[model samples]
Target chain A: MRRAVGALLRKDLTAELRTFESIPAMTLFAVTTFVLFHFGLDRSSLEGDLAAGVLWVTLLFAAVLGQNRLFVAEEEQGGFDGFLLAPVDRTALFVAKALALFAFLVVVEIVAVPAFGLLLLGPDLLDPLPGLVLVLLLADAGIAIVGTLVAGLAIRTRARDLIAPLLTLPLLVPVVLAASEATAPLLAQAGAEGPPGRWLAILAIYDLTIGLVAYGVFDFLLED
Target chain B: MQAPAILVRDLHKSYPSIEAVRGIDFEVARGEVFGLLGPNGAGKTTTVEILEGYRERTAGIVSVLGHDPGQRPRTLRERVGIVLQGGGVYRHVTVRELLDHWAHLYPAPRDVDEVIELAGLGGKQHERTRSLSGGQRRRLDFALALVGDPELIFLDEPTTGFDPAARRAAWQTVRTLAELGKTVLLTTHYLDEAQALCDRVAIMKDGRILTIGAPAELGVGALYRVVWRDAETGEVQSRETEDPTGLLHQLTSAALARGEPLRDITVARPSLEDVYLDLTEEPSAAASQEVRDG
Candidate 1:
C-alpha cells in the first residue's frame, strides 16, 4: 500500500514538474480572481470581512483551475494507462493524486495569499499569516479529497464538460463557506487569533469523511 | 497443494436488463498462454475483467491466485498484471519518468532502461507518451503490465491496432512471458494470433464458450478444400472433404484414364477462423461438444 501510494504521488509530482502547466494556470487564475475582488470592493470597504470573502472565492476558482488541468496532463500524454497498469491499489492512486493536487493548491496559495494581502490591502493583512495558512490547509485538504475523485470520474463521463463543475461546485460550497468564516477572526482580532477551533473542526470532519468514503469506493469505480 | 492460476465455475454477471456474462466456466493452467477468442460484445472482456477482480460476479465462483478478486486484495493484485483496452496516461512525463514511477510499485522490478528496450521504446525513452505513435503507446502499455513481473497477466485484444511487425514483436513478448513462467489469459479477434500464440483457446459467442481446445484439435485442418477444373466444359468444381490427399490421387487417376488433365486446381486446409465460425454458428452442436469435452 505504501509503495502504491508513493508511486502514484511520484508520478503526479514528476509530471507536474516536467510540464508545469497546472501551476501557471492556477497562479494566473488565483491572481486574476484576487484582482477581480479588489476592483469589486474598492478602498472604502477593504476590511477583513471583505478580505475573507475575497480569499475564499479566489481559492475556489484557483482550485478549479488546478483541478481542471490535473487530469489533462495525464490524458494529453496518454499516461493514465500506465497508472492503471501499476500494481498500486486504485484508491492509493486516488490519495496520491489528491496529495499532489493539495501540494499544487498550497504552492499557489503561498504566493497568492501573501500577494493578496500586501498588494490589495496594503500590508495591514499580512499580520494574519499564521492563522491564514492553517485555514487554507484545512480548506484545501477538503477540496483535494473530493476534487481528485470527482475529476477522475468526470473526465470519463459523456457529460464531462458539465459534470466536473456540477460535482465540484456542490462540494466546494461547504469548504468555501467554512473558509470564508474561519479567516474572520484573523483579520478581526489584530493579535486576536483566528476563527474558533470549531470551524477548523468542521473542515477536519469534512476532509476525513470524504477521504474515507472516496477511498472505499475508488477501486470499485476505477479499474481496467 | 498448488492452485490453478485462475478458476471460474458457473460465473454469471448481469446488468439491469441484459446479462453480459452468462454462467461460463473455465480454468487457465499455470504458466501457459490461454486464450479467449470472440467477436465484439461476445462477453470475453467481461469475463476477463471479472477474473482480474475488477468487476463482481452476479452468480458464480472465481478464484484467482486463490483469492476472490471482488474482495480486491492487494496481495492478489500484487501477483497479477493487466493490459487495459485503452485509456489516457499522464501526458507531461517522459516515457522513462513514467516508467520509473510505475517500477517503484513492485518490490523487484526490471531495470527501467531494460524495460524500455523490451517495450521497443529505447530511442523514445525521453519522449512523452502522447507524442508516441499508436504502436509505441501500446508497447508502453505492455511494459506497464509486465513491470511487476506478475504471475498472472490478463491481456484484452492486446494487439488490436498494431501493424504486422509490431504484432509479431508482441507475440514474441507473450512467448517470453510464458517461458519465464507466467500464466497469461488473453482475448483477441485475430484468429491467426490465437492459433500461433495460445496454448489452449476457448471460442465464445453470445455469453458461452463454444469450444475449448488446442488450435489443431479444434477441427482446424480436419477438413480440406479441393478445387479442380472439369475438362469437358472447362468449368470449375470444388469439394470439401476429410481426406484430400486420397481424393486428389483418385481424381487425378480417373482423369488420366479418361485422358483429361486436371487444370486450375487448388487445395487448402481448414483454418482456425473456419473452425471458430463453425463452432459458434451451430448452437446445439457447440453445447453438445462442450458437454463431451467436460
Candidate 2:
C-alpha cells in the first residue's frame, strides 16, 4: 500500500512538473486575484480583518482550481482503471491524491503569501510568519481532505467543471471561516499576535472528521 | 487437481433500461486460451468486467482463481491481469516508466524490460505515451497487462485497431503467454482471430451465449460452399452442401464426359466466420439449442 501511494504521488508530481498543469495556474490565479482586489478596494495597504478575509478567499479559490485538476489524469486517461486493477488498498489512491493537493496548496502559498504581504499589507509580514505558516498548513489539510473527496465525486459527472467549484466552495466555507479568523490577529497593524487556539482546534477537528469520512466513502465512489 | 482458471455459472447483469447479460454459464480451464466472440451490444464486455471485479453481477455465480470476484480480494487481483478494451495510460511518461510504475503494484511482477519486448515495445520505451501512434499505445496496454506476471489474463478486444502486422505480433505475444502456461480469456469481434488463437470460443448475441465449442467443433456439421461455371449454360452456379467431396466428384465426372472443364471450381468450408454470422444473424429462434462442451 505504501509503495503504491508513493508511486502514484510520484507520477502526479512528475506530470504536474512537466505540464505546469495545476501549481502555476493556482499561483497565477492567487496573484491575479490579489491584483483584482487591489484595484477594486483602491487600497495601497490593508490590515487585520480585511487583509485576512482577502487573503483567505483568494487562497481558497486558488485551492479550488488546483483540486479541480487533481483526478484529471486518471479520469481522462484510464488512470483510474489502472489504479483500480492494482492489488493495493483503494484508500491509497485517496491518500496519495490528498497529499498531492496539499503539496500544491503549499507551493502556491509559498509565493502567494509573500506577494500578499508586498501588495496589500499594512503590518510587517515577518512578525507572524511562523504562526501564519501553522494556520495555513492546518487549513490546507482540511481543504485537501474535502477537496480530494469532492473532486472524485465530481469528475464522473457531465458538468464536472461547474460541479467541482460549486460543490467545493460550499464544503470549504468552514475552512475559510476558521482560517481567516485565526489569521486576523496576526495581520493586525496594532501588533502581530498568535492566532487564538480555538480556531486552530476547529481546523484540526474538521480535517480529522472529513479525512475519515472521505477515506471511508472513496472506495464506494470508485466503483462505477 | 487445481481449480479451473475461471468458473462462471448462470451469470446475469442488467441495467435500469436493459438486461446486458442474460443468464450465461462457462468455465475456462487452467492454461487454456478462451475467446468470447460476439456482436455489438452482446454483453461480452459486461461479463468480462464482472469477472474482473470491475462491475458486480446482477445475479449468478462467478469465481476467478477460486475467489469470488465481487469481493475483489487482493489475493485474486494479484494473480489476474487485465487489458481493458478502451482505457488510456498516463500520457506524460515513457512506455518504460509507465510499465515500471505498474510493475510495482503487484507483489511479483515480471521484469519491465522483458514485458516491453514481449509487447513489441522495446524500440518505443523512451517515447512519451502521448506521442505514440495508436498501434503503439495498444501494445503498451498489452505490456502493462503482462508486467504483473499473472496466472490468468483477461484481454477485452485485445487487438481492435491494430494493422495486420501489429495484430499478428499481438497474437504472438498471446501465444507466448499461453506457452508459459497462462490462462487467457479474450473477447473480440474478429472471427479469424478467435479461430487462430482460441482453443474454445463462445459466440454470443443480445446478451446470451448462442454457441460454445472449439473452433473446429462449431463447424462440425456446417455446410461448405462450392462454386462452378456450368459448361453448357456458360453460367455460374453455387451450392451449399454437407459433402463437398461427393458433390464435386459428381459434377467433375459429368463435365469430363462433356469434354469441358468445370471452370471456377472452388470449394470453401464454412469457416468460423461463416458459423458466427449464421448464429448471430438470427435472434433466439435458432439459438434455443445452445451448444455446450467441456
For all predicted structures, in order, the TM-scores are 0.82, 0.91
Mark the regions of model 1 whose C-alpha exceeds 4 Å error after superposition: A71-90, A125-131, A149-224, B1-3, B13-23, B220-225, B231-234, B240-246, B258-260, B264-269, B281-294
* Predicted candidate 2 versus true structure: per-residue lDDT over A112-218, tens digit per residue: 99999998888999999999999999999999999999999999899998998898999989999999999999999999999989999999999999999999999
Q: Which one is best on DockQ?
A: 2
Interface Cα RMSD for candidate 1?
A: 3.4
Against the unseen true structure, what C-alpha lDDT does each candidate score? 0.80, 0.91
DockQ of 2: 0.65
**Which segments of candidate 2 are over 4 A away from where they belong?**
B15-19, B86-88, B222-227, B238-249, B266-268, B283-294
Per-residue lDDT of B10 in model 1: 94
Clashing pairs in 2: none
Output the TM-score of candidate 2. Answer: 0.91
